[model samples]
Target: MVEEAARRDLAAIAITDHDVVGGIAEAQQAGQRFGVEVVPGIELTAEWDGRLAHILGYFIDPAHPELVVGLERAREQMAAHVRDVLDAARALGVEIDEAALARYRGRYVSGATLVLGMLEQGILRGSPHARQLLLRASREPRPFSAAEAIALIHAAGGVASLAHPVKLRRSEPLLPARTFAPLVAAGLDGIEAWQIVQGPTVRDHYRRVAEALGLVATGGSDCHGPRSVGMRLGTQRVPAAVLSAMKQCWRDRRRALPDRTGSPR
Candidate 1:
C-alpha cells in the first residue's frame, strides 16, 4: 500500500481501518519509511436505524480514552461478526472454512478493506448488502458497527466527515440538510464536498449544502490500501481553511471535554 502511494507521488497518506484504529502505528511507520505524511485515522461503521453509516476520522489522537474504548470494542465485535459469517456460510455449504477465514482476516483489516475487497472481487454490490450480509450479519463472522461515529470522531481529537454519502443513492435520507441541520447545530464539522465519483450536478449540490450548513468542504481518494477505483491516491485537494476549521474544532472539543469523551448530542 505504501509503495502504491509512493508510485502516485503522494505527500501524505491516511490509514483508516474500518471501525477500528489498529493500524495507526504501522501507517505512521510506513509514512516515515516512505517520506509521506501519515494521518492517523479510523473509518467507523456506525449503527443507523438498524442499518449502517460510515463516518471518517482523520488526524485523530490515538490515546484518547473514549475513542480508544469504542474502537477496541468495535474491533472485537467485527472479529466476532466475521466468525459468524464463516459459520453461516459453512452451514449453507458455501465451501468456506476456518483456514479461509484466517487467510482473509489479515487482508480485511478494516471496514473499507472488507467491503472494498468484496466489491472488487464482485461478491457484493454496495452498502445495503455490505450492511445486511457483512456488517449487520453474515455467513461465518460478520462485521459490526460502533456507537455514534460522529461522537467517536470528536473524541479522538479529529475531524468528523461523511464518506461517500451520495454513493448510497439515498443522500437525501443519509445526508440531507434537514438531517444534518441538527448535527451542524451540534457541531458537525465537515462534508466531502468534492469527491472522486461525484458528477458535476452532485458536486454543485454538495457544495451548496456545505456552504449552507457552515461545514468545511473536503475531498479524498477514499483509497483502500493500494488499490485504485479509477481515483488516484492523493489527487483530491481539501482547502487549508477547511482543514484548519476541523482541527480547531477538534482541539476545542478536546479542551472542553478533557476526559477524552467528546459527547456530541
Candidate 2:
C-alpha cells in the first residue's frame, strides 16, 4: 500500500484498517522511508438505526489510552463475530481452517478476507446461501453507537468523518444527511465527499451537504491493495485544504480539552 501510494505521488495517505492500530506503525515507517506523510487512522464501525455505519478517524494518536482501550474492546467483539461466521460457514458445509485463522490472533478478520478465502478454496462462489450465512454471522455483536465513536475519535485527538454515508443502506433519500446534524453535534468534523466507487451524482450530493453543514469535505480511494477491484490509489485527490482544516480542528479541540497527552501533531 505504501509503495503504491508513493508511486502515485500522493502527498499523504491514511492507514485506516478495521479495529486495529497494529499496521499504522509499520506504514508510518515506510512512509518516512518513501517521503510520503502517513496519517495514523482507523476505520471504526458504529451502529445507527440498526445499521453498521463506518467512521474514519484521521490524524489520530495510535497509542492514546482512550483509543487503545476502545480498540481492544472492538477487537474482542470482532473476534467473536468472526468465530460465529466461521461456525456458520462450517454448518453450511464450507470448510474453513480454524487453526490457520488462529494464527492472526490479535488482528482483525475482515468479512472480505473470510469470503475471499472461501472463494479461493472453491467452496463458495457468490452463492445466495453462502452470502446469507456470512451476512447473518457477521452481525452478531453490534458496534459502538455513533456518539460513542465520535467521542472516541475526539479523545484520541483526531477528526472524525462519516465514511461513505451513501453506503449505509438507508432507504430514505437524504436520511444520512438528516442524521449528520446529530453527528456534527456529537463532534463529527467532516464527511467523505468523494470515494472510489461512488458515482458523480452521489459525490456531488455529499459535497453539497458538507458545504451546507459547514463540515470539511474529504476524499479517498479506500484502496485495500493492488488487487482491490475498481479501487485505484490516487484516483480521488483529497484537497490539501481538507487536511489543513482537520489539523486545525484537532488542535482547537485539544486546546479546549483538559488533557493533551495524545495530540497527534
Off by over 4 Å in 2: 99-107, 125-131, 138-140, 170-176, 261-265
- Model 2: weakest 10-residue lDDT segment is 99-108
Model 2 scores a C-alpha lDDT of 0.77
Candidate 2: tens digits of C-alpha lDDT, residues 66-162: 9999988887887777777888777777777655543333355655556555655556676657678656654545568988988898788788898
Work out the TM-score per prediction: 0.73, 0.87
Query: Which consecutive 10 residues in model 1 have the weakest lDDT in total?
Result: 138-147
Pairs of colliding residues, candidate 2? none
What's the C-alpha lDDT at position 239 in model 2?
81
Candidate 1: lDDT of 165? 58
Reference-based lDDT, each prediction = 0.61, 0.77
lDDT tens digits by residue: candidate 1, 147-213: 3577767666777776665754553523556655655654567777666677567766777787788
